[model samples]
Target: MAERKAFHVAVVGATGAVGQQMLKTLEDRNFPISKLTVLSSARSAGKAVLFNGQEHIVQEATPDSFEGVDIALFSAGGNVSKELAPEAVKRGAIVVDNTSAFRMDENTPLVVPEVNEGDLHLHNGIIANPNCSTIQMVVALQPIFEKYGLNKVIVSTYQAVSGSGTQAVEELYEQTKAIINEESYEPKILPVKSDKKHYQIAFNAIPQIDKFEANGYTFEEMKMINETKKIMHLPELKVAATCVRLPVATGHSESVYFEVEQDGATVADIKALLKDAPGVVLQDDPDNQIYPMPADCVGKNDVFVGRIRQDLDEVKGFHMWVVSDNLLKGAAWNSVQIAESLIKIGLVK
Candidate 1:
C-alpha cells in the first residue's frame, strides 16, 4: 500500500478563541500534519501555543506566511482574511476561511460539508465557512430537505457569548459576577462590538447579533438567510432569520421552522432521516424531556437535533431544534473538515 501523505498546515489567528479551537480540533482529529505553522496578529504574534503536545510559537501573519503551506485554515477577523487569504492562495495553499470576507463572493463557495461538500470542487482556491448559527442549522436541515424537498425556512438562533469571541465571554462572566454581588458593571461588548452601543449580555437575551443593515436584518441574520440559499443551491428559496445572543458560553442553538415541498411528510419521517444523517445526532425523545441545548453541546463536533414536530396550522411546515459547539463545528471543525474534504477528493496534495 502507498504511504498516506501528510501535508504542511497553517492556521491563521492562532491566538483567538476560534483559532485555539482549530488547533485543538486538528490535534483531536489527528489530522495528518507534516508541518504546522501558527500565525496571528502582530499583537498576539510571539505567543506560545501547544499542538500535538509540542509547543509552537505564533508568528505575525503576512503574505509570505503561506509559503510551502498546503492547506490554511483562517479564523482571524474578516479584515485579516481579506488581506491574507489571497496571499495564501497565491502561494498555492487552499484556504478555508472562517469569516464573512469571502462567503458572498460569487467566485468562492460557501460550504457546509454535509450539505455541499461537492461545491468544494468549484472553489477558486478558497472555501467560506458559513456562520456558526448557520452551520448547525444546515446540518440538521439537509437530510430533511433531501428526503422531502425544502421550499422555505425561518430560523431564530440562540447563540452563545463565545460566538462574539473570548472578550465577550469574559464580559459576560464579569457582569454576571458583579450583578450577583450587587456591584455595578459596564457593558463593553455584545450585539456587535464596533457598533455605536453595547448591551448587557449576562442573564439577558440580545435580539441583535451583528449590526443591522438598511433592511433591518442584522448582518448575522442576513448571513443565515443568504448562506442557506447558496449552500442548498436554492436561489429562490424563501429564508428568514432572527439571531439573538444569549449568556451561554459555548454552543449555538436554533429554532428552525421549514416548509417541505412534498406533501404528507410526517414528523416520524423527518426524525428517521436526521437519525441516519452524517454529522448529526438525533435526541428527540420529548417524553423524557430530551432536547439539544447549548450547555450540553459544548466541545462536541456533531450537530445535535431534537424537538421535531409538525407545525399545527401549516401542513407543510415542520420545526426542530439544532445545536452545536459554535467554536468547533461552527468555525474550526468546519474549516478543518473542508481541508479533509479537499484531501479526500484529491483537490489538495
Candidate 2:
C-alpha cells in the first residue's frame, strides 16, 4: 500500500469568524496536513489559534506568506484577497478565495463543489467560493436542475447576522439585550458596514445585505444571481435575488422559486431526487411540520432542504426552502471542499 501524502495548508484571516470556522472544518474533517500556516491582518497577527489541539500563532499576511504553501483558503476581505491571492498563486499555491474579489472574473471559476467541481481543472491557480446565500441554495437546486432542466430561479435569502461577521453578531446580541431591558441601543454594523447608515438587525429584518447597485439589486443579491448562472453553466438562465439580514447567528435560509424546462415534474419526483442528492438532506415532511430553519442548521456542513411544492399559478414553477450554516458550507467548508476536490482530481499535488 502506498502512503497518502499530506500537503502544507495556509489559512488567511485566521482570526476572523469564517477563518476560525475554516480551521475547525479542516480539523473536523481530519484533512491531511503536513503543515498548517495561519495568517491574518497585521492587527490580528500573533493571535493564538488552536488547530487539532495544537496552538498555532497567526502571522501577518504578506506576499511571502504563501511560500511553500500548497493550498491556501482565503477569507480576509475582498481587498486583501485582491492583493494577496495573486501573490499566493505566484508562489505556487492554489488559492480558494472566499471573497468576491475573483468570482466574476471570466478566467476564475466560481465553484460550489457539488455543482461545479469539474471547473477546478480550468482554474488559473485560484477558485472563488460563491456567496454564502448562493452556496446553500445552489446545493439544493443542483439536483433539481440536473434532473428537470432549470430555466429560471427567484431566491429571497434570510441570512444570519454572522454572515456580516462577528462584529455584526455582537451588535445583534447587544441590541437585543438592550431592547429587552427597555434600554436604548445604537446600530453600528449591518446592511453594509462601510455605508453611511447602519440599521437595527435585532428582532428586525434588513432588506439589504450589501451595497445596492445601479440596477437596484444589492451586491449580495447580484452575487447570488450571477454566481448561480456561472456555477450551473447556464448563462442564459434567468435569476433574481432579494437578500435580507435576520437576527439569526449562524445559518442561512433561502426561499427559492425555480422553473424547470421539463414538463410534468411532480413534487414527489423532486423529493425523491433530493433524498439522494450529494451534500443535501431532505426534510420535507410538512405533515409533521418539518422544514429547514436557521436555528436548527447551525454547525452542520450539509445543506438542509424542505418545503418542496409546486407553484399553484405556474405549471413549471416550484418552490423550496434551503438552509445551511453560513460560515461552514457558505465559506470555510466550501473552501476546504474545493481543495479536496482539487486533490481528488489531481489538480493539486
Candidate 3:
C-alpha cells in the first residue's frame, strides 16, 4: 500500500487580505498539511485567526519561522517578502511569493500555473505569483495564444479596492454610505497610496494605479506588460495596459484588445477555445444579458471571460472582458494552485 505524504505549510502575513484568502483556499482545497504555521508582522502577532475550524494565533514572522516549514505562502508587502522570503528558502522551504519583489528577477519563475506551470521546474527557490491583474489576463489569453497565436495585447483594468487591502475596502464602504447620508469625508488611499495625490475611489474610477513611470505608464500597467511577456515567454509580443481603480471591493475586470497571429480566426473560435481552457469560465450570452461582471465573480477561483467579438476593421483583432476575484484567482488561489502544481510534479519536498 502507498502512503500519503503531507507537508508543513506556513502562511506569511496571515492577517492580511490575501493571506487570509490563502489560508481559506488551502482549507477549501483540502490541501495535505501535516502542520500549518500562521505568520504575520510583529504588529499582527498574537492575533487569532480561524482556520479549518480551529483558532490559530499568528506568530511574528522571523527568519527562524521556516525551520520546519515545507512550503511558505507569502502575501506580505514587498518589503516583508524581500527580507524573509530568502530566509525561508535558505531554511529549506519553497516560497511562493505574492509580491513584485521577485517577479522580474531572472532567476525567479513568474508563474500562473495554467500559463506556465512548466516554468515551475526552473525555480531556484522562489516562485512568484504575477500581479493580480496580470494573473487573470494571462489565464484568459493563454488558450487563445495557444491556438491562434498572439501578436499584440492592450488591456484596461477596472480594479477593486480590495487589491489595496482591508483599509481600502473599509474606506470604500464608509465613503459610499457617507455620500448617501450627505456627510463630508476625506480621501486618503487610492490611485497610489504613497503618491502625492489622493483620490476618492467611491462613486468614481481612478484612472491611475500605482506610481507612474517615466515612460508615462503607471507601475500597475508596467507590471501587466512585463509580467505578461515573462509568463507567456513572449517578450517580443506587443503588450500595453492602462489600469484604473473602481468602487468595487473584491473583483477585478479587464477589457482586453488583442490581435491574433492567425488571420481567419472568428469570434466563435475564440469563445470555443476559452470555453475549454483550464482555469477559465466563459459567460458570454448577449441575448440573455449574460456577461462577466465583478459582482458575480466574488469568491470564485475561475477567470470569467466574456464579451468576445471581432474588431470592426482589423480581421485579426479581437476583444474580451476578463473578470475574477482579485484576491482569489488573481492572488491567493493562484499561489495555492502553484503549490499544488509543485506537489503534483514532484518539485516540493
Candidate 4:
C-alpha cells in the first residue's frame, strides 16, 4: 500500500484474445511492472507483442520461464494451466489464472473483487477467475442478495462466439459472408470444437456452448450453476442456466430471474440498490426504450443492468437483463482486477 516499485510480471497466453486484453489492461491501469514477460505455446512462441511502445518477444512457456517473476496472468487453456500453474507457483510467482482448471480447487480462490475479493487472501499462489457469465451475474445480483436475501436464480445467456476463441470469431465472420452470398461454407468451430458435431455460428443461434454432461446440461451451463454457488459461498442456492451461442463477435447478454426473501419488493427498490453498487451501471428506462445491449457494452468493464421488473406470478421474484463484454469484465478485466486486489490487500510482494 506504500509507494512501492513495479514488480516483475508475466502473461502466459500473450498472443490470444483475452491475453492481449490482459496486456492492454495492465498498461491501461498502470499496473506496476518492473519486467514484463510474454509467453505462449510453441506455435505462438517467438512472435512479437508490443507493450509500452516496445516489442516483447513471446517465449514458449515452461516451468523455468516463471523464474524471478512476481505475478503471472494465465489464459491459455485448462490443460496448460493444469500443467504450468503449479510450476509457476513453485517458482514463487503468484498466479491469477483465467481458466477453469483450478476454479473448484478448495485451495484456490475463485474471485470477482466486487463480489468476493476477501477470498484472495486464502490463495496458495493461485486464484481462479469466475466464469464470464457467472462474474457478470453475481456482480449484478450480489447487492440485491445482500439487501433482500436470495433463494434462487435462473439465467439464460446469449453468449458471443469470441468466448470460444479467436478462431471461432473468424469462423463466424467467414460463415456469415458465405451464407449471405449463397456460397458453401464448412463448419469447423462452434458449439464445441472438439466434439463430434460443429454448427454454423454466423447468422445462427446454437443452443449449446460446450459438451453435454451426464445430466443433459452443457458443460458451460453447469459451470454457471456450480461456480455461482461456490463464488457466492451459497451451496444451497438454487441456480439453473441455459447457455446459447449467438452470431455476435463480442459481449454476452443474460436474462436473469431471481427470488428475493423480501416480499413485495418493488422494481424501484432494486434499481436504487444497483444504481450505486460498485462495478454496476444501471440502464433501465422504459420511457426511452433504453436498456443494456451487447453491442453497446463491447469495450466497457462495468456490468450493465436493465429491464428490472417484478415477475407477474410471484411477488417475491424479479427479472432483469445483464450485459457485459465477456472478454473484458468476464475474462481479461476480471483477471487484471484480481491482480490489482492482490496489490491492494498486501498479498503481492
RMSD of each: 0.8, 0.8, 0.8, 1.0
1-349: candidate 3 lDDT, tens digit per residue = 8676899999998999999999999999999999999999999999999999999999999999999999999998999999999999999999999989999999999999899999999998899999999999999999999988999999989999999998889889998999999998788877677899888888999988889899999889999999999999999999999999999999999999999998789999999999999999999999999999999999999999999999998999999999999999989999999999999999996
Stretches off by above 4 angstroms in model 1 are none
Q: Each candidate's lDDT (Cα)?
A: 0.93, 0.93, 0.94, 0.94
Reference-based lDDT, residue 74, model 4: 95
- Supply candidate 1's per-residue lDDT for 27: 93
Judge candidate 1 at residue 62 and give its lDDT: 97
Pairs of residues at least 3 apart in sequence or in different chains that clash in candidate 2: none
Ranking according to lDDT, highest score first = 3, 4, 2, 1
Off by over 4 Å in 2: none
| Reference-based lDDT, residue 72, model 2 | 95
Q: Cα deviation of 45 in candidate 4 (Å)? A: 0.6
TM-scores for all candidates: the values are 0.99, 0.99, 0.99, 0.98
In model 1, what are the clashing residue pairs, if there are any?
Answer: none
Local distance difference test, candidate 1: 0.93
**Worst ten-residue run, lDDT, model 2?**
184-193
Q: Write the per-residue lDDT of candidate 2 for residues 40-97, one digit (tens) a residue.
A: 9898999999998999999999999999999999999999999999999999999999
Model 4 whole-model lDDT (C-alpha atoms):
0.94
Candidate 4 least-lDDT 10 residues: 1-10
